[model samples]
Target: MKKIVLAIDSFKGSLTSQEAEQAAAEGILQVYPACEILQIPIADGGEGLLDTLLPYLQGHSISLYAHNPLMELIETCYGIASDGQTAIIEMATISGLPLIPPSKRNPFEATSFGTGELIKDALDKGCRNFIIGLGGSATNDAGLGMLQALGYRFFNKQGEELGLGGKIMKEVASIDTKSIHPALEEAFFTIVCDVINPFCGPKGAAYVYAPQKGADEAMVKELDAGMASLASVIRKTTDRDIAVCPGAGAAGGMAGAFLAFTNCLLKSGIHLVLEMLSFSRRIKNADLIITGEGRIDRQSAMGKVPYGVLTKAQEQDIPVIAIAGSIEEVNYLNQAGFQAVFSITPAPLSLQEAMEPIVARQNIRGLVSQICRVIEINPRVISSSPSHSKFSSFKKR
Candidate 1:
C-alpha cells in the first residue's frame, strides 16, 4: 500500500491509543517497509482524551495538587493550549471511580471538587475556553462540590453552608452564585459527553450509575432524591432547567451544573474529537484506515471510535479495517461500514492474560502483519472490491 492511517482508540486497561497505533505500524512495516504510516491517537472524550488531543492543540500539561473523590489531596494534571486561553480537563483524572478502591467507593461521600479546582486554576491562568470530558467520575453530587470549588455556595435552611459530597445535595436549600468566579462570565465550556442520561429521574445519573459507585438500593434512592432536590434549586436559582437535558447526568450531573451555571454546550464525544482533529482532512489521501478500541460490540457502531473513523473514511471512499481485543456481532459491524473486522487474539485466553500490555501489543502487531501480507498478495482484495464483498469473504474465515 502507498499510505495508511492508524486512527485507533485506547485499549482501555492495556495499551493506550498511541501504543496501539505503534504496534499496528510495526506490523504494517513488516510487510511494506517503505510505506508511509500516519498514527493518530484517539479517544472519545474519556480517560485518555487529554493525551490524545494535547499535541494537536499545541498544549502542555499543567500538574497541580487536587482533591480526590474522598477529599484527599492527590497530584493531578490538566492541559492548556493557545497560550493558556483554552483548557482540557478530563474528569476521570481527578474524581474518577478508579481512584477509589471498591471497598471505599461511596457516591454519597465522593466529590467532584478536584475537577472544579482544575477549572478554577485554568480560569485563573486566563483560560476562557474549556473542553471538559465528563466520563469515569466517582461522584453523584449534581456537581455541588464542583460549584463550591468554583466559588458558588450552597446553603441549608439554617443558612449554613453545605459541605462536600453527594449527600450534601439533599441538604442544599439555597444557592448563592454571587461569589462565583469573576472570570466565569467570560468563559465558554464545551462538555464532551457520550451518554444521554438526564440530570434526574429513573434513567438519570444516580439511579443508573450510583450503584456502580457503591450505592445500595437505599442509597440509590436517597442519592436520586438529592439529585432531584438539587435540580429544583438549580432551576429556581439560575432560571435554567437541566433536569431533562440529554447528557446532563454525565459525570454525576456535572454537565448539568455547567449548563445551569455557565455558557456551555454539550457535544457527542467522538464527533467532537473528530471535528477538533480535522479527521476527514487528515485522511483525505489515505489508501487505508485502521481503527478499533478494546472491544467491538453492538455499541461499537454507536458513536464509538471505530464507527466515527469509519464514517469519516466513507466520506472519501477509503476502505476501513478494524482490529479489536475482542469482537461480537460481526455482521452488524460489517453493515456499519468496516471493510473487515478482526480480533487480535491469536488463541483462546482469559481476559486478564489478553489485557497484558506486552501481549496485546504483540498480538496487534502480528494480526496487522498478517493482514498486510494478504493485501500485498492481492491488493485488489481490499482496494477494488465492494465493501460488502470484502467483508463477506473475510467472515467465512
Candidate 2:
C-alpha cells in the first residue's frame, strides 16, 4: 500500500475512531513500515459528531451547563466551526438515551428541553449555521419540550402549562410562539438524520424507537397519538405537515419540530458529515480505504458511516476494506462494493470480552498484519486483481 486512508467510524461502547485508526495503523506499519497512512476519525452523526468535525472544521468545543432528558441540570458541550458562525449540536448530548441510566429510562418522561437549551446557547454565542444531529434520544415529546426551552409555550385548553414528556402532549391545547428566540428567525439549521419514518405511525418514532427508551405498548400508542396531534398543530402554525415527513420521526420528532419552528433543512447524517469534511476530495487518490464500525450488518448498508465511506471509495475507484467488531449478516457487502470485511474479534470470545478496546485493537492489529503479510508475499496479486476481483480495478484509463 503506497497510500492508505483510515476513515473508520467509532466502535460504539468500545473504541473511538481515532483509537481504531491507531490500532489499524500499528498493524499496517507492522507489515508495511514504509507505506503512507492517513487517519480520519469519522462518525455517522449520532455519535462522535464533534470529535469527527473538530479537526476538519478547525472548531472548538464549548461547554455549557444544561439539562438532561429528565430535566436535571448537567454539563454538556457543543462545537463551533472555525468560522464561528456554524455550530454542531448532537441531540444525544443532552436528550440522549445514554444520559439516563438504563434502569431509569422513561421515554414518556424524558424531554428534549435541553436540546433547545443547547441551541439557545449556541445562538447566544452568535452561531447561526447549526448542524443538529438527531438520534439516540430518550424522549417522545415531539420536541415540544425543546420548544418550551426555546421560549415557545404550550398551554392546555384551560390555559395551564402542561408538564414535560410525550404523555403530556395530550394536554396541549395550543402553542404560543410569540416568545420564541428571535435568533431562530435568522438561523439556518441542517438536521443530521437517518430515519425515514414519519413523525407518527406504526413504523414511526414511538413504535420503532421508544421501546429502547423504556416505553411499553400503551406508551407507544399514547406517544404516537401525541406526536400526531403535535404535527397537526405544527401544520397550523407553519402550514407544513412535518408529522409525515421523512426523518420527522427521528429524535422523538425533533426533526419535524425544527422544520416547523425554525429555518431548517433535513439531510442524511453520514452524507452531511462527509460533505462537511470534503471527504470526496480526500479519498480521490487513496490507494486503499479502511472503514467500519462496531458491527457490519444489513443496517450498515443503509447510510451508515461504513457504507457512506464505501460509496465514496467506489466513486473514486479506490479499493476499500472494513475492520469491524462483528461481521454478521453482512454477506451482501461484496455486492454492495466492499473489497473485504474482517471481524476484529480474532477468536471465539464472548461479546463483552471481545468488545474491550484492548482486545478489539489486538484483533484488528493481528488481522491487518496478516492481510498485509499476504499482500507482501504476492506482489503480483495487487498488479493483477483487487481483493482477488472482489473490488473494481483502480487502474487509470
Candidate 3:
C-alpha cells in the first residue's frame, strides 16, 4: 500500500471520524514507513456533518433558543460559513429522540416545531443557502408542527386551527400558506436524507419508523392513517403529491414537508456530503481506499457512509476495504463493491467494552497494520515505479 486513503465514519460511541482515520493512518505508517497517506474525515450527512464541515467552511456557530421535541425551550446551534450566506442545520439537534428521556418518549407527543425555528434563525442571520441534515427524529406528525412554526396554518372541518400531533392530522381540512416566512421565497435548501421510504403505507414513515419513537401497534396505525390523510391535503393545497415520493418519510415526513413548502431538493445523504467535501479530488490516484462505519450490515449498502465512499473509490478502480465495529448480514457488501471487510473487535468482548476509546483504537490500529503487511507482501498492489515510496500522487485539496 504505497498511496492510500482513509475515509472512515465516526464509530458512534467509540471513535470519531478523525480519530478512526488517524488510528488507521498510524497503523499503515507502521508497515510502510514512507508511504503517502491521505485522511478524509467523513459523515453520512447526519450527526458529524457540522464538525467535519467547520474546517472546510471556516465558519462560526450561532446558538439559538429553540424548542425541543416535547416543545420545551433549549439552546442549540447551527453553522454559518465565513461568507455568511451558507448555513448548515442538523434537525436532530433539537427534535431528536435522544434528547427526551426513555420515560418521556412519544412520537405523537413530540413536535418538529423546534426544527423550523433553527431554519428561521439561520434566515435571520442572512443565510440564503442552507444545508439541512435530517436524521434521528422523535416525531411522527408529518412535520405539521414544523409547518405550523413557519406560519402555515392547519384548519379543521370548522375552519378552526388544529393543535399539533399525528392523531390531530385526521381532523385537518385545509392549510393556509399565505403567511409563510418571507425569507423562504429567496432561500435555497439542500436536504440530506438516506432512507427512501414514502409518506404512507407499510413501507412509509409511521410503519417503518414510528415504533422506534415509542409508538405501539395501534399508534403506528393511527400515525400511518394521519400521514395518508395529510398527503391528500398537501396534494389539494400545494399540488405536490408526496404520498409516494422517495425519501419523503425521512425525519418523520420532514423531507416531504420541506419539498412541498420550500424551494428545495432532497439528495442521498453520504453522496451529498462527499460531493460537498471534494472527496473525489482528494483520492483520485489512491492505490487502496479504506472506509467504514459503526456497523456493516445489509442496511450499510443503502447509501450509508462506507457504501458511498466505496462507490466513489470504484470510479478510479481503487481497491476499497471496509472496517466496522461489527459485521452482520453483510454477505452482499463485497459484491456491492468492497474488496474486504473486517471487524474492529479483536476478541469476544461485549459491545460496551469494544466501544472503549482506547480499546477501539488499539484494535483498529492492529487490524490495519496486519492488512498493510498482507498487501505489502502481495505483488498485486506494487507499482511500476522503481521505488515503492514513489507509487502515486493525488491532490490533497
The most accurate candidate by lDDT is 1
TM-scores of all models? 0.93, 0.93, 0.91
User: Please, what are the lDDT tens digits per residue for candidate 2 over residues 1-397?
Assistant: 6778999988877888899899999999997788889888888878788788777889999998899999999999999999999999988888888889999999888889999999999998899999988877888888888898889988888998888888777677788878999888899999888778888888888899999999988888888888887778778877988877888888878887877878888998899888988889877667778898888987888879989998888777777788788886656987787777888776789989988888888888898888777666754333234433432332321
- Taking the tens digit of each residue's C-alpha lDDT, what string does model 1 give over 172-277? 9998888889999999999998888999999999999999999999999999898888889888888999999988999989999999999999998999999989
| lDDT digits (tens) for residues 200-318 of candidate 3 | 89999999999889999999998888889989988998899999999999999999998888899999889988987899899977878899988999899898999999888767677
Regions of candidate 2 where Cα sits further than 4 Å from its true position: 379-397
Candidate ranking (lDDT, best to worst): 1, 3, 2
The per-candidate count of clashes, in order, stands at 0, 0, 0
lDDT of 3 at 196: 95
The alpha-carbon root-mean-square deviation between model 2 and the true structure, to one decimal in Å, is 3.0
